[model samples]
Target chain A: MWGHVMSDEKKPVRKKLKAASEASRFMANYYHELDAASQKGQPKIAWCTSVGPAEILRALGFLVYFPETHAAMLGATRMSTELIPEANALGYSPDICSYLTADIGAFLRGVTPLSRIYKGIEAIPKPDVLVFNTNQCRDVQDWFAWYGKKFDAPVLGIYTHRNVGKITEAHVASIAKQMQELIEPLEKVSGRSFDLDRLKRVVALSRACSELWRNVLETASAKPSPLTFFDGTTLMGPAVVGRGTREAVDVYKILLAELNDRIKDKEGAIEDERFRIYWDGMPVWGRLRAHSDLFSGLKASVLASTYCNSWIFSALDENDPFNSMARAYTELFIVRSDDEKETYIKKMLELFKVDGVIYHDAKTCPNNTNCRYGMPQRLEQQTGLPSLTINADLNDMRMISDEQTQTNVEAFIEQLEENQT
Target chain B: MKSKPCYAGVDVGASRTKVAILDTSKNLIGHAVKKSGTDFTATADACLILALKMAGKKKSDIKNTVSTGYGRKNVSFARDTKTEIGCHAKGCFLYFPFATTIIDIGGQDNKVIKLDRSGKRTGFKMNRKCAAGTGAFLEEMAMRLDVSLEEMNGLASQSKNMIKLGSFCTVFSATEVLENIRQGKNLPDIVKGVYYSMIKRVLEMDALTEKVVMTGGVVAHNAFMVKMTEEMIGRKILVPDYPQLTGAIGAALYAMQNKP
Candidate 1:
């Protein structure tokens, strides 16, 4: 809200992403349906991690809900600060993942942003079952298990191996075997038979949606960058929570078309795009607007980031759904080696043509904080692109000093400008 | 005699405000440093007036002005604001003219800025979120030791058996300082420990390049701190003629370069 000036037109003029609003509306409707799932004879609710096998859950006739996405919404709406202390009061450490703490806090308060803002539900729908995989973070298991006990729901966890080197067929087969073993417990919890044919179709739709989302993000590579990573963070809601459904695919299809049209018309995120930057780690949930404006005010747009691109499943194989899903999910950039990370960072810098990089070291997340201290220096040495990291929390605004962060960013931009001269 | 236009730079730092005026040929004509009181605008204006008088010119003789430091925006008369990092690099480069790693220990922060051979900034870091390696910590230590700030440098230089501070944190170091004082440690030895603690914290912000240049208000008041820093790193460290005025001088240089 600090740096972004919204359009003043009475009609909704799309200065930002139109798909972001559509995704928000879709999420509100989805939550409403979840509230009335039993009355409307809709699918049962299943809580899962963002990177979990949501397609399988959809195939099992369950409405997938991601607590992480809900936490991010609370963060975006500036309500996480109000709810996080409730979890801290319950003995959750302030140093734990902010998403886990915020979700627990929100649940303990018996309220959701859906009811307060969107007028959709009085509370988040209680899960009939919970499922998770440890592809990205270690907190998901504990987060889901706690909710399972709180709501008297059955919990199902699929263990995934960390891919240290190249992911082999054996790794894929092992995870696929676990996926097969997972169905019986899920079937028992939802009281529905698992159908491979339906799962195959859902997996196909999920792959299609991921492709469209990747293409949408790639449009920023156009000269002047049609959108910034801030837009991507908002528009990424459907891809994370509503991955397998036709609605998710449709959202990205619309977003991809809009971004393509913007590229054709030479529209840019900032008026005068002077320097492009590669953003590392998560967005400072409470201060996204402040940071966004700080860069846009300097005519620099964060054209790409490693956070939003985490959901791009370009490695997914539709023909071999389970095995390919195993490889695709396990081989994420977050769980990769330093050499792999270096290649990925270098590739994004080249593709986006960024002049430098900015890293938000989320104090509450150890997973996101890896390779950060040394990565900037290594990247600069390898690619000749400069980088700076500011320490802040993702949801907790108390850990951030706006003035200090702004000063560091201004000095960094000034250095980038000097390099150009 | 012809009345010629001159440029000015104002650095409104946390502890003090500095002003430097330069003539057309890029010479440091006059400069002033004063305690930054409650009102930053008033203090900056006072500093500018004093500097202009020393340069034998009125305020109207200034053609352009640039500002820097934590309170850069508070200078109402400045036409534009440059970052302290950029200004520091430019000011040090004017003296060194080579690839340099500058360690500027300021009032509330410390900065480690690296520059390439062509005088462009390659990398830089600022330590503002903490008070471990800053002049604020020195003042706090001095107050805790019940000694005046001016006596710290001389006392540190006179230490025969120097004590090493057990903690790098300002609060903890202050507690340790109190404990040592209660245990009857020598005053100069305790002061020397404080100096060593400050230098150790500053050096850890970033690796020092071969040509290390130290600047800022802390270095201006404490020459022994620089001597200890050189000793710690086991190499010679370069410093500007007026260490506290480097940022202001760089801002004035910016004003000169931007003149229409």
Candidate 2:
């Protein structure tokens, strides 16, 4: 009811990716395997941060589960707004990460959106061990600690340096030592010996998978991008949850091939690509479809984002798994200094040939929200590209006013139009 | 004699609907303002009819129409629609013709838009999902003070010492006003305090340029606010002759420029 009045005839149709089915299947299989492992209790369950050392857990015979992915699921299903208040009732501030609030609240209420999708899964897999890295944010440590306390699971943390401008050997060594310390605890929980060969194999698969995922994202640099940020968010499921596995590599290979074919045929993610925009923060999980449709209607392709490109771990090397994992995770855009972030984003804008930038000032995700620090104004001064900041939350729908966002986005497009002419 | 074709712009805002008609030479020939009631399309049509009558022209004389403001899309007769941001910028630039920051305090939103000397927009910011610094905040404060919205401006002007409100939230400010009234504070002082709060909120939204122009319905009615803002910033602020009609006039200018 609250949207633009563009006619159906005028709205450009979104071209669906052919490999989405394979990616979906791959994700389902990965979740089901974890669910089975949880039930059997044979393969130990390890809860890891999305960007944590998942390969180590997998190699040590632990079924790794990412609670952040489950939080994203809660957000996507629109259940987060209802469930977040449950955590709030328990003294969690509404200003903290909505994902933590919603996931913890869902756990407290004995409900999950996953039950409806994955048959026979009443709740998320319980963890035998919980691992986290502070590269993403300090909040993930708090989030994992809560679960570790409740489940009586051993909590392992790899505290990395923040605001890193350049990934130094000292930084890498510090994180690598912390990661190396996890092996003994991980082996004790899994009742298995640590295998360096197994870790090497898993790390190699992760490297290959990430390379293919990067290629899939880079395909957007082509004229009339073969994909949009909306597509990347959904397609990056394998790269997030299924990394360090052959299934993840296989899924990305299929995806990259299909995108290449789309590029060869001069096909675009939308019918008309009048403008290309760079998105510089977390996705509004609940409003993804609405936003995707909104941009498609405007004939604008949001071709790049700091969120989707966060998973490209090109520095990963199988020969030096511990140090490489440390280097790859430490070099994340979220952990970088503002200077490095600006350099990275400017390169992305030029690489994608973007016409404008949209900075989503997500209220709950201050770490991901870049506009609060005058990055938008600074970027505009340097690149001469217009930028608009929309205030919303990644998971909290209350923070979003559809009418206000619609007006701001339309005005930004108009600004781009004026600049072009 | 055949009538010359004129361009029309309708600004269907959250609180009011305005229509501005311009001749082929971009002269402001007619304009009308009316409260935008429940039905935005109906309010827009009525304003357009009144504006056309004021211009002594028929609806057939309008060759192009552009609509702006919050309800811009609801105007059925508009050939196209532009945002209130662009419209305000265009409208203000037409009068100032220089690098200026335009701060528009509308019914439900406030915008601080910057433009270069060449009329290109440098950047802009709007109030984020709040009604603290707009006309809505003033209206709420007026109701809480049990005074007419029009009387508050005069009351604020008559204040000997203004009380500054600590909270920026409209709801909190209303409670603060009641507490002041219970404390036997002077009515004029409280009213001026409310005005100061509004100005402080807007100023915090963005930094003003060397040349700042204030517009919109609030600026048109509340001249004391303009004086207070100038005193606070220690600079003379510019105002258009008809502040409320600038958005509509800008829309009309756009209609004229894009006329088929």
Candidate 3:
């Protein structure tokens, strides 16, 4: 048995961040509470986007369910394909973000993978109201608005202007003002008073978790990075779903510790870790495993990404919660100019010490993917780091050609490998 | 003494399977291009056999095989697979040997790959979720215009005035073609517009470098496209002797370099 388990005799087992189990449990419980909200009949449930000010909802004694998270879950479970056609039948083009299609399709079909994963739940807790911010994409505004219309629920949207230069004080004030105005509509739906103290407490916890998550992501800066973008994508769920909660902070603390330990042991996400690459844009959610294996098989690990780093709160100021939240949300890398985006990419490349970049051109999100055609060239000119852009859809499984994607990625790794010589 | 080792590259494109066999001297000995059909495995095997016969070599003469393109993995006999991006870059660089941008408009997809002067690929971009720039779009337009794909090049070259297609989508472009035909637009003019649309779609994928090399079965069949691309970019575009065999040749190069 020992002989059979010799280094070259046995295939290497891909080691994941040990804290993943704890994080999954935290997410499951978070979902469980949201699913139980209607049964308890006391706390109301609200549907929100991943980037919405969920701390406010948490502070207001309502359980929040991020439909985007659920939609991603649908994608991972291979159930999205079944749900997408339902949306197609209802006039949603396959060209729209698959998250929207799958969510609406699941709702239209009256089922969810979550319901099946956790027994005794009919579906994701239906919301009493819907809330979202316009910091990310047009899809956020349209997706949440669709739910608001379907449920006849009052919708509260916090709109952020696309920042052309550095974020201004006026920008912060305007969005902070919206945060104040949001209280009334939320109060009306939840039938509860908005407590400022509770919000401050939630914001403090959110800041702590963001710090821990940032540290966890930074651990990949070590040679033979102990984490991959694939791991970060899954580990990021707590930061999105459990933001503003002590439980989420605890989860990240554990994750950060495990990552640091891996660094100490000289452990890597991929066994040889010959090269590190950065991934930009949304993941090909349906083909995450296939994509991950494509790189790891070549001894190249995608150690860092703009997608997972979107959750970090490097700009957040806990002392002035609302104003800082406004600044942090508005200055997202996605909405910034190509020149400014290059500056940030340069910083990430230095910090992660990556050899190359893989820019994923997700089909539906034009706001994020359209600017990509010029990015690879500009970044290469500036940093001397090569990049490859592979076309894919975030949730739509139909659009991906595994053969094409594999060929592109393999060739990219080959170039990186050749550069080593 | 061992006979000179030969390397083989198989490009399993979505629409067609291509094979190129090269001797150790890096000279192309034989090549074949055939429709991919439904079974990539069978098509790839058939292509390899046809090319091997053309080269007058037995299977034992081949030392290594590498595959690329959309159906790369379906080639069961290949020792390895490479992306069409790397292959296209290597293939084009072999011809130009300078900082070059490669535009490959295949049957179902289009790729724009950039390379440094040393033939190292610096970056690349592929058309996303649209068929406007690929050979499929042209095939649809050809069917809609009731002309053979082979005749499209000559017809477009004869046009005195080119008609512009408003819709970039294949389905919508077909309707646009019909509407143009009904409006009594000249056949040559309509075909010319289709070529312009194809060129515009690919050019929009990325910014071109000083030296641009165009490859693929579409360009191989439609020499007029090269002229159209040159006029549009206001610069001479480069093409390999056998445009359809570039990806396969790139794979063959990889095979020669990475022999087992």
Candidate 4:
């Protein structure tokens, strides 16, 4: 939990006023609908997302799998793009979105090269229900909408509105109540008992993951840093799909061992690492190498990203799932308002101690992009950290200005270096 | 002494592969396009062989080979694979140096390229995601109702009524097309709706949206440029003689360049 603590300087402090007046009544009406008298079997629900939201749901005992994560690994191996045309022939528009078109294309062609959903290249299993949080990008939301329409299943869009200005008590209460209400539907669908104890356990797991993630970020504070964002990214997959599980914990332990070994050797994710930069916002989905090479020549190592640390909440499950999940979901960096968002950045600067931040203003993504204008200014003014705002689409070339983006990044790094002396 | 071997540039597109051949002086000796096959290797070979036969040269006469498009890396025969972006920039510089913006509406993807006087890749954007305005989207709608792609465009230009394409998703748009038809909207008006909707989608991504016009698959098939789009944006969109084949010609001419 980067934070959800109450702050005073923040304004527009309206505490769950609407929920108190309206949504609360709806919640009571729905809660009695369950009452342990009418509800029977817990519905078989599956959580779906990229790395960020998957970890949060995993803590709550929800079975989760990441389609984008699976798709990216395929893309990394160069399978999805190959399947684009066939997917188009099957009625998926190639222009609709590359990932969707490609994956469906691969499915239609029946020639995808992936080995498995997990290692050893096995078949992917489909879940009865899908849950997604809208903290990452709106594309996931739209993509999931297709999934919902195709499967004709219930689609839950968890909107985590970013508080760009400042946070107040009203903000926390408004969101907390939303979180409590959002889960009731799940309880109705799953028939899983919702108790304070369960949420607390989920919260504890969130804290553990966040704590481990914080330690990893702290490792970047070293001069000529022992770890790179690549190392952090690889470790993130486990959290993405298996968080709150014993398997996820083991995945991190193994990854941590490997990363620690590399750090001790003073080896970077890529050798000849020079600049240690922070990557903010969603990754350019398709042009990953191009995105990396945009700064690769500068010896720049993107050590931390806002997306990578997004799900890292501080509250850990001492025990129970309800309190833990409630607190953790409520505490997500993107889910919180001005107080939490600003404080999260401040904490990252204190922890990672990086010199620069490249705020990737993903063109189509309002959730991540909305925070940039005011956020960069505030972070720089207080931390004295140099920041550059680059406009590019997340994973789509439709919005990237490669030449201008390159020139900007180069100039920003130069300006940063000039000031270091 | 070794003679400077000829080079081949083949664009294995979604529906077709347009190939071009050039010698040491980088002159375009021959050019041909064939229906792209199901397999990448087969399509690459068919296009290359056709270009070679037209050039009166053997496969060995080809010193180097380049493949571009989404299938760039899959070309088992290519010496090196460059993205369609790089190749398009090189080709557009050679073909239309003054054309600041290049819009390529292939069967599936829509890409907008910005080039400098020197043809360097100044910046470019592709609709890697979203199908609200692509040529493929229009084609699907055309086939669903058993209307020809040509008739889809021609009939659309004839209509004056506005048929709003409310949903941004392609499948949903197809459904919307059907829904409009059920609502007694005339065939021509439905076609008009698709063209108008596409232009709006294009405007969202193109930095030079208002200033540019037809030069890809969409221009050729549904040859009618969305007049409403031009009027809405208040700018003229330049249309080349053959918008469909411009990219191939651009690729062919790019191969003609002697410059490194």
TM-score of each: 0.95, 0.97, 0.90, 0.53
Query: Least lDDT summed over 10 consecutive residues: which range in candidate 1 chain A?
Result: A1-10
Clashes of 4: 39
lDDT of 2 by residue, B142-253 (tens): 9898899889889999999889898978899999999999999999999999989888989998889759999999999999999999999999999999899989999998
Listing every candidate in turn, what is its Cα RMSD in Å to the true structure after a full C-alpha superposition? 3.9, 2.3, 4.2, 15.2
Name the better of 1 and 2 by TM-score.
Answer: 2
Highest lDDT scorer: 2
The ten-residue window of minimal lDDT in model 3 chain B covers B120-129
Calculate model 4's interface RMSD in Å.
Answer: 20.1
Error of 2 at A104 (Å): 1.2
**CA lDDT of A310 in candidate 3?**
85
Q: State the TM-score for model 3.
A: 0.90
lDDT of each: 0.85, 0.90, 0.84, 0.59
lDDT of 2 at A402: 92
Model 3 agreement with the true structure over A226-315: per-residue lDDT tens digits: 999999989999998988888999999888888888899999988988889999888887888877877887788898999898888766
How well does candidate 2 score on lDDT at residue A54? Answer: 96
lDDT of 4 by residue, A168-243 (tens): 4455455456556556666655556556655555555555656666666566666556555544554565455445
Better of 1 and 4 by DockQ: 1
Tens-place lDDT per residue, model 2, A187-211, is 8999999999999999999999999
Off by over 4 Å in 1: A1-14, A38-42, B166-168
- As for lDDT, the candidate ahead, 3 or 4, is 3
